[model samples]
Target: MAKKKSPPETLLLLPKWPSSAPIVDTHTHLASTFEAYRTRYKDHATVFDMVRAFYHNTTVEALVDVWCEAPVRTVWREFADSALTPEDRTLKWGGIDYWFVMGVHPHEAQHYTDDIENDIIAAMSHPRCVGWGEMGLDYHYDNSPRDIQRSVFRRQLVHAVKLGKPLTIHTREADDDTELILKDLVPKDHKIHIHCFTDSPEFAQRLLDYFPNLYIGITGVITYATNTDTSTVIKNMIPSSLRILLETDAPFMVPANLYNSIPELKGKRLPISHSAMIPWTADFVAGLTEGKWDAERVMIEARENAKRVYGI
Candidate 1:
């Protein structure tokens, strides 16, 4: 007779955040995150449904979702519009404050058109559209030609600057060009978000020193063992400076600590990251601070920094 196989351990529910500190995810992709969830579970899940499932017991207060496609996703309007009123926000997003920034990501720089630029400019006037971008150089993939990315980046920077909108920048492995272009084009006092930074500590310090108002958008990537730059940057930052912003950059960079926190997960990975996971990111960040910070303190500081940057 053959021996019977044992069933695998059921995944445990996500641990509840230990503090009342409000979570403000400075950058995320809500629609894409929803798609990831639907694909993973093979279920018909709406964005709000995914939100409820992930954000249930979390202290997620606000999210600055990115809409950076070339043509721009029409679905963005529905989300930005829905959060116009308290009742609608409660009904649609479970009372979580939702805001967005619109622009063409560097990966889509080649496809950028005048019409697309016009569309992004119009969105800047939107009551819920807080800033411009998720835009800049990305040499890691070089999905678009270098020259085209630089040209489109400059054009968008000009527009965002003219409109006096805060900037959300994405730079990967092109630190020199990114630094030069930003320093030449953007004013020192301009509100800039260097989203998902994984570059050298020197590059981070240069940006931080040059642009006092500029913030480093820290994502779950910081918790990964392979990237010490993000951790080092956090450790070196003067705690009183308040230059870090907590974000998940979700549907991506799900914090590795999450797996360790829940033993039943058993080395299995979660298919998606969301705003609710901010605390885990904060917890890891707390660990990096040499007992100077806690998860709640990290959340609170990030929340205040988000307001200063995005004014949401």
Candidate 2:
């Protein structure tokens, strides 16, 4: 008798989830993840294959793939054709419709120039580009001087406002300045999201009160046992209905619980995260809701919320 074939190695590495739960990953870095996967998987991996593998267990149907530093042209060339187009309209991520956000991150503030601004202006004309960001302050790293970071962020904010597109912000130790600039510049009618929010409840409340269209994006950070603050903010501060959304911020914040489950990645120097693990984060949110909200309800509303804010 012929020997039976073994299952694909990917099966063992992925987390299990209920297929009935549909999720939309509101923010991700698929371009960076694509590069990482290409290097690791070599000739064997395509983005389609990566999506297929990701969809096997989780119910993530759509994702907004964001780029912080790379030019919008590069982002579009990599994902728009294979990933952004929808296989079906109703399903959203059912066939995983993809979208993108473009901006210069604070880290690259030193490089921000007229040429960069022009590139962003030209990119705004693209149909698939729905939002502007992964931009804001990061005083902790201060990778770029504080003055430069503020200037670059304000420049992008001006363009994003002019374009009538939503803004995705990344604020760290520089919350005070972030709030000041945003409050002064971005109109209350325009949408803004604080992506990967790990700030205090006071900060969350301040932003929500200041920006009528502001939304909080929860990532895999809440899944880490050490991240009680994020979970607390989600449970008490953020509105459960439509003002919140889910994201992976992939190739960065993998769900801590799921990360621990994989044996091979336990001691690895660096592990990879992708949009596929959204269900893990969603489940964590459901738990934080404490029977007040279920995973499906949260995911569905978040999907609609993303659609509204991102204009997808």
Candidate 3:
């Protein structure tokens, strides 16, 4: 019989925010892990895997889950239930308190229909739904035609404005068009955030000038030494912590520091990203600010900004 190989050592050197850090991951996708598990290992994936996948939530005080596409009914139900149930056991499990935003992603803009709109509107009535979006243009992919993406985004913007909810925006490579749409459709006083902001410093300045309450969402991508554009803007342009929101964009932009440094997570079929990675991001942001802002200060400001914008 072949001898069983010992498990590879997983590095645990990534920074951990204190339990009292008041951290709020302002944007993330929650259903990816379960969905992947269901698709690949439906028979073998146990409840334990689901729990382990979500065990990342232990790192943050609260989270803003973004539903960019229509989630299966059960996932939506579970999210709503988590928001309503607040027992100590749940809390001990690193039960993250949550608020959500829903909208059509630019890649899926062509698939948008009245039914989808109505479904989103109806979901807004759920006690946990607090904003509208993850919607905007993706000139890079152009998965949906530019015109169609713009039209779908505008319709959602109108609905969000009328509904009195904040906007969770997604703009990439089409900064001018995104700025034009926001200028034309969104109200000046409305709460708007550029989630996973990777735009130019000039564009950041333009939006900051145009929208008094606009906030920029920062994610673990900041940990990458190659991502100079965002790092430069964070370092030189955005001086005030008040205009920033910390996010994982998870199951997506797992930080370089966390991704490359972690030992146990190595040799995975795919890299896993989670809200628990936000502290690594917070630490990175502190370094970018040259200690002008520490991890605690960044987390505190982000929490307050999330509360004010999302009305949680």
Candidate 4:
């Protein structure tokens, strides 16, 4: 028999959620399709095994087909009146209403600079491209060179400022460099967020202080003790109005810390790409707010902050 790591329930690390609140899963890797799977095509899926399983196969129409288009037009056209393309889905909810961040990640940066630069230019001209992404240093992996990562990230930030779009940053064990670069390079108008922040409270506070436009995206990591500590610290440190955002970052970071998190997900490939995860993300935050979930609060706060940063 195999030894099982205690179930999340036994771990008792349910993330915050709200019963009354709807949600907004703000920062995700979904738009970043190639970054997730450019190297490994072992399964013949376009992206890596984790991402393909997560986001590619949702049944829901309102929020289905985030990264990849569902083959059947029927599933998408029900809630949204559009064809089965990612561009169609973005326009379905409301014409050009849905938005996403795009860029070459640190790892892929080495190989795809020229192509990604073109993509960024095209995205800048796009009416709905709202942000520059999950593009920052990851010394944790050092998958790309330090200088190159800095160059691509800086270029993207410059573009974001030029476009007046917000920026979503991701860093791991590169906090010192992250802070140093942001301080020196971030433009006055660059709306910024350090998403999935798992760093110390002191760091969070300092960032909040330095960049008034800076936002912190808290995720399911808040539900677990370790993740909770980070969230608690940020909440305590940052002001209530500083554009705090929430995200699932799925079909990657599955906030599976809930007791009822995935009751029906059994034996399912999970599609790993559900936007439906937003409500769960909301409930997770609401749970932390008062041990009960309120979707409304999450939606309002998240949207208001998002609108402020995104100007949408």
- Candidate of highest TM-score: 1
> Tens digit of lDDT per residue, candidate 1, span 1-312?
974332231232367867899999999999998776665563335888667656777788899999999789999998899889999889988889999999999999999999999999999999999899989999999999999999999999999999999999999999999999999999999999999999999999999999999999899999899999998899889566558899988879989888777776655666678787888898998898888888898889889899999998
Candidate 3: deviation at residue 215, Å?
A: 0.5
Q: Identify the runs in model 3 with alpha carbons over 4 angstroms from their true place.
A: 1-19, 36-59, 70-74, 88-94, 237-239, 259-270
Q: Candidate 4 on 1-312: residue-level lDDT in tens?
A: 974332222122222333434345566544343343333223434322333243233211221122211111122123222323566644433222345556666765566555546656564555555676757788878888888878877876777667776777887777788888888878744688787788777778788878888878766666665565565754574335435676666546555544366454343323233344565555566555553325456656776676666665
- The local lDDT score (0 to 100) that residue 285 gets in candidate 3 is 80
Q: Candidates' lDDT values, in order?
A: 0.87, 0.75, 0.75, 0.56
TM values, all candidates: 0.94, 0.86, 0.85, 0.69
State model 2's lDDT: 0.75
The superposed Cα distance between candidate 3 and the true structure at residue 210, in angstroms, equals 1.2
* Number of clashing pairs per prediction, in order: 0, 5, 3, 26
Better of 1 and 2 by TM-score: 1
Supply the TM-score for candidate 3.
0.85
> TM-score order of candidates, best first?
1, 2, 3, 4
Number of the candidate with higher TM-score, 3 or 4? 3
Q: Single out the weakest 10-residue window by summed lDDT for candidate 1.
A: 4-13
Question: Which candidate's lDDT is highest?
Answer: 1
Expressed as tens digits, the lDDT of each residue in 1-312 for candidate 3 is 984332321222244445567667888776774454455444426433453345553555677888887432446656666566577326432466767888889999998999889888888888888899889999999999999999999999999999998999999999999999999998888998899988797898789888988988899887777777778777764466548888988668777765554456555423446667777787778777876887777777788888878876
RMSD for each of the candidates: 3.6, 5.4, 4.3, 8.0
